[model samples]
Target: MHPTTTNEPPQTLLDLITDVLSLLLLSTITVQSFIGRWQVLRTKLTSLQSSLSSLSESPLWSQNPLLHTLLPSLLSTLQRLLALSRQCSSTSSLPGGKLLFQSDLDIASSSLSNHLHDLDLLLRSGVLHHSNAIILSHPGPGSDKEDLVFFIHDLFTRLQVGGVEFKRKALESLLQILNTDKKSASLVVKEGNIGYLTGLLDFNDQPLIREQAVSAVSILAASNDESRKIIFEEGGLGHLLRILETGSMPLKEKAAIAIEAITGDPDNGWAISAYGGVSVLIEACRCGSQATQTHAVGAIRNVAGVEDIKMALAEEGVVPVIIHLIVSGSSAAQEKAANTIAILASSGGYFRDLIIQEKGLQRLMHLIQDLSSSDTIEHVLRAISSLSVSDSTAQVLSSSTALIIHLGEFIKHGNMTLQKISASLLANLSISDRNKRAIASCMGSLVKLMESPKPVGLQEAGALALVSLLTARWNKKELVRDEKSLMKVVQMLDPKYELIDKKFPVMLVNALLSGRSSGCRKRLLDAGACQHLQKLAEMEVSGAKKALQRLSGISLKSMFSRTWRE
Candidate 1:
């Protein structure tokens, strides 16, 4: 009889048989993608070359006096694109060469987009929409900053007086300049440009013109504290909200970012919330594109830091949407969502319990372990520290070996915030025996953390984690033998410098002193901790005094005076 065959192959067997199909599909996709891009690139490059060659004769462009300011940038960008395309052609056959062609394609595409964007900005900025009278009135070029200001002001005055000629090309050009040059953005804001920028956002203004104006306003607002204060006082935040509520996706995105940046000032948070800004931001986070959602999440991050706004965000039912984005949003959006969650989770018990109830931690755990980005990890670590404040959540999170290992590894991270948060989380996990054992297994990492070079603020957290590991009792012998770790703990006892909170280090030494292996006490005495402890005793720190007396078997009454005893 023939043996019967099963319908499903074993997983390894199935995977082994897939190489032929996968390789063919990959080659087909790569070849098709490169071919399509190369054709498009060649077509665009040829057109640009033709345009540049005939620029001296082109009527709409070269023959027009008004096109003077736009020609140079367009010419330069075309030349650059032509050069890059040639480079791509040269690199197409070598090892890892497709990446170069692909990179060239991307750069050329974005450059074209930015150029087109500039053209559109000018067209929509009211420059081309109005009569030739203003076009002919254009001043050729300014000799200095003051002349530039006068040129811009003349256009603003024309707009203000509600008469005379085309949309404010002069003002439009200045805003576009400020958009690209940050230093000049500050200067424009300093020259009192807010009134005119806001005028561009007037209810009757074209959406496109208002859009670019909003962008310029946002750039200026980001320049400095004084600029933000100026924008905020000029009702700039309200105009931004109006655009966010009523404009195109591009305008909304810029407005959301501006609203978010402005709210970084502590004074504006409640005002934004009062404008129903939080509700709108939550909506954007729910349905906006990846880029929009990134900006929206950042806005939420800033607004939600205010207790009122954080609570309002929760009331709008955003947590579930945020959790969804954490699971499926683009990488940039995910990082922003992580920060928002971190802030919300720290708000209070209700937010923490809700996040746990929604399985937010599971998604956050995936982000932390999979992304391995330092910023994401730091934010997730902060979220975990906040969520773990609950004993119920602790019992669950404490079992993640991946998380514990990351925490231990982060102990030596370059970012002090991350190191301290890692230490704090490790300290929390030490409360559970399972986690305590996990931490004890990573004993060397903990010791290394204690020896961090920037020891300031590190000890407040590092000391607690040290105490947890050393207090495991089963692990004390190995921990005490680590002379670097032992000496670090000893060094923390010096009241001469406020290295860490005296309480944590004192508890650590007391824990170590109890049930000492003669080796442990000798480790302390040999590390010069006895002298540091004497200094603590004379300063009337009881924990240090008792630990010192136990170590040296000496009376303190005669050695230290009453004034020093407290």
Candidate 2:
């Protein structure tokens, strides 16, 4: 048994050597495969590093147009490389996923910021197209939250540059963001971007940008007194005046509105005037564009409300300019011109006659005839109301048959506001004897209108006209034949309807207290108007009480004056 075992053992040595050789061969193959994979990965990493280095060195990477084209592609490549690296490192148990993701994020963020910096440079250099830049800079729909915030912050920072194109894009972006998300606007302003907007008025180009900027400025100006102070401190007034002087019609229009916002408070009026804003605005009135002229005229009117500005504007020949604008300008221009004249006429007592001498009365009469717009008619009526109060205007109204007919036609219109204004103008005209005669000639038609179910306003107007007519010396003869029309006015004093009840009694009291003539007083008393007035004095409240007091004062004055004259 021992000899047989020795022989089997001896046969095994060669077989053992062959098995060890086979094992060594397999291990070598495995090592070679791993080395080849490592080389491939190292080559890839080197290639990526070179690409990154090249990207960092290129100035174009920061340009908005170039970067806009490059960023997405770069981000995609980085993401893909990161995923591949993560997969490759997974089998090795390396911390590659988090590291790769963070590196990619950091790289992408830095690149984006750098690209935005280039856009900012372009904006500063005044080379970029505003609208295109805005489109390029805005965050895409699926942009990461952090990236969006960074993009917005960077865009806001660049807005301070003085380029018109840049400002347009920035403003467009701001407005768009504001429209979509107010929170973003709040954030933008919170970061002191408002100062940049205020600075934009200094730029020489881009009126549209300035127009848009003014809207934002108005919003910020309304926030508080402190913000308003900032607006002024930032030279907002001077810039606005410059725009008024040099900018286009649209720019001037917007600038005027902005100036109004800044000067709206009574406290700021003197400051605004002191800054030469009034003179600048007056000059803007001479612009060729109707809109610009209208806005400028409106601004001047507002400034005229301040006493010093009014004197300054009058000294500057603003009245004549306004008259010219009205006489020859378009309908809108004329409307604004009339408003300016009205403001001047009210402020400068001597200016009304001047306006009439300038044919302002004739021009306004023409507008009243030709205007179909309710708003234009209303403006013209108001101007007429102001003008008609003057003696010079009374002469014009008395002679113009067309004016009287147009006013009567307007009274029949369905708009209550127009009817009220027409009535007011007629009341002012009735101050003159000739005006009273002209109005009395229309009494038959007016009485019918008063009875119409149009509105309480027309009734009030008709009643006022009747009072004027009955009170006028020459006019009373015309009404004497229409005893029923006179009696109808007395019947209106009964106070049945709310409006009729409230106003009719006061009018009766007024007529009895101070009739247009002595015979007018006698006729009203004979109609039992005194009894109606006495009843009203007892029942009136608040405004009605005030009206009764006025009636009493008029009656007392009339009695004393009559006694003195006797």
Candidate 3:
């Protein structure tokens, strides 16, 4: 569903980030008494978190009666433990915190003990249980905990009196309403009704009720922290897994959507995988309807972003299932499937080798040849980019004329990331002498990309590709043919290129000046490239000075002092 793109780590990633941040927090904690409570609670929280993480290994963890009884109670404590132990500036807790939030770590670290009693109350409040009444987020009149009690009392009375069909409509309507707003979604999930909601999925004859349950849980998981945290704690994912295994067709589709939403956070991704979502999603993509396949692929995409989870998927042999979708599934399914493969392949080394060994690149190239929608193009470009990083994969891609030409067009112009990635692939493909012309076809785009804004790494890549293109006699003439093009090549020598200390671009400058074409030489001079060259020649740089001597000689040096200074 790609409702949004994110690279921000979930709470699970905090252990790593905190380890890095802990060195920073060390002196701060030592100076004040803040170390006392923080050290104790942090250690306890660590133990609790380790316990929770183990549960993510399998649903069998849930079947242990001792664990099943203890987990629900411990979850609230863990939630409050995590929440209270946070550095005051926790970006995860604070809105807009990821980009610009710094916490008063001293104060937050010191205050951990004060929350023990409050946490006890919060946990005793039964924050994870499922019930019938709707819990409203509004703190207005008749909306407090007492108000909820009365509503629940009244709701059960009506449910007992209402007939079966009437009961189904009431549950469906509540789910519909809850799905409408974060407020309602938050209330339902935080109030622990997700367990009750998932229980409805077991009514074999009531698919609508089951579908609504899946849809509502999807909404709740997507809403905000309260719902996300509480629902996930209550084994909401295990419930969804059950639905995927046994529900009717429409119910399966909704369940798939809900599973994707739940696993979108990396914290939940491992839990679902432990429950065997990797195999189920693979089967769903293979056998479900097009929409079901699409959503299932989307779920796979999210779960696979967790590096270990992706490794598990590869281990389960679903890489072939995903590759199969690129050729045999609907366009939407292919797009998500391609994206899923792209992320896995991007994990590098073993992942790339696995895809290549699976003949994944061949299928992806086939996708490029046969499919041309914007979405499909984006995914295939990403996929090929990952695969092409390998020398062997690069060799396969170089042989595909369709891929080179299509990618050249994309490199020349597309979305920011698409153009940058396309240029990178071209750089790799250009390693093969046979593929330089294909990349050369996109010179106009490459020239512009060298001037692209910060973080592109495009200039280095574009220059490297140009160096390869210039290896062929005509390509040097082709690039130098336009005076603006000649200058753009010269401009790449600016020392600001952070990739490789700008050495590759300097080698490119050397390539341009040392070329055999008199026309290219004259055009280089005409475009004031000698000014850039003389500047480099005078510097202590190795490649630039050697390149100048190879291109022109002491006569140009004489001209440099006379003409360049003026």
Candidate that would win on lDDT: 1
Alpha-carbon deviation at 171 in model 3, angstroms: 1.2
Across 394-440, the per-residue lDDT of candidate 2 in tens digits comes to: 77675677776676666655366676676666665634566556556
Candidate 1 regions with alpha-carbon error over 4 angstroms: 1-143, 161-165, 190-193, 202-205, 431-457, 491-506, 525-540, 545-566
Number of the top candidate by TM-score? 1
Q: Which stretches of candidate 2 lie over 4 Å from their true place?
A: 1-152, 160-172, 175-192, 204-233, 248-257, 260-268, 428-462, 470-498, 501-566
Residue range 93-157, candidate 3, lDDT tens digits: 55445233224433433333323322332233432232232322323444566555433323322
Output the better candidate (1/3) by lDDT.
Answer: 1
Give all candidates' CA lDDT scores.
0.65, 0.58, 0.62
Model 1 lDDT tens row, 354-408? 8998999888877776875678777887888899888877877777877877776
User: Which residue pairs in candidate 1 collide?
Assistant: none
Off-target runs (Cα >4 Å) in candidate 3 are 1-169, 179-183, 190-192, 203-211, 348-350, 389-392, 430-435, 438-441, 491-505, 555-566
TM-score, structure 3 vs. true: 0.65
The local lDDT score (0 to 100) that residue 508 gets in candidate 1 is 75
Task: Write down the TM-score of every candidate.
Answer: 0.66, 0.54, 0.65
Q: Residue 114 in model 3: shift from native, Å? A: 35
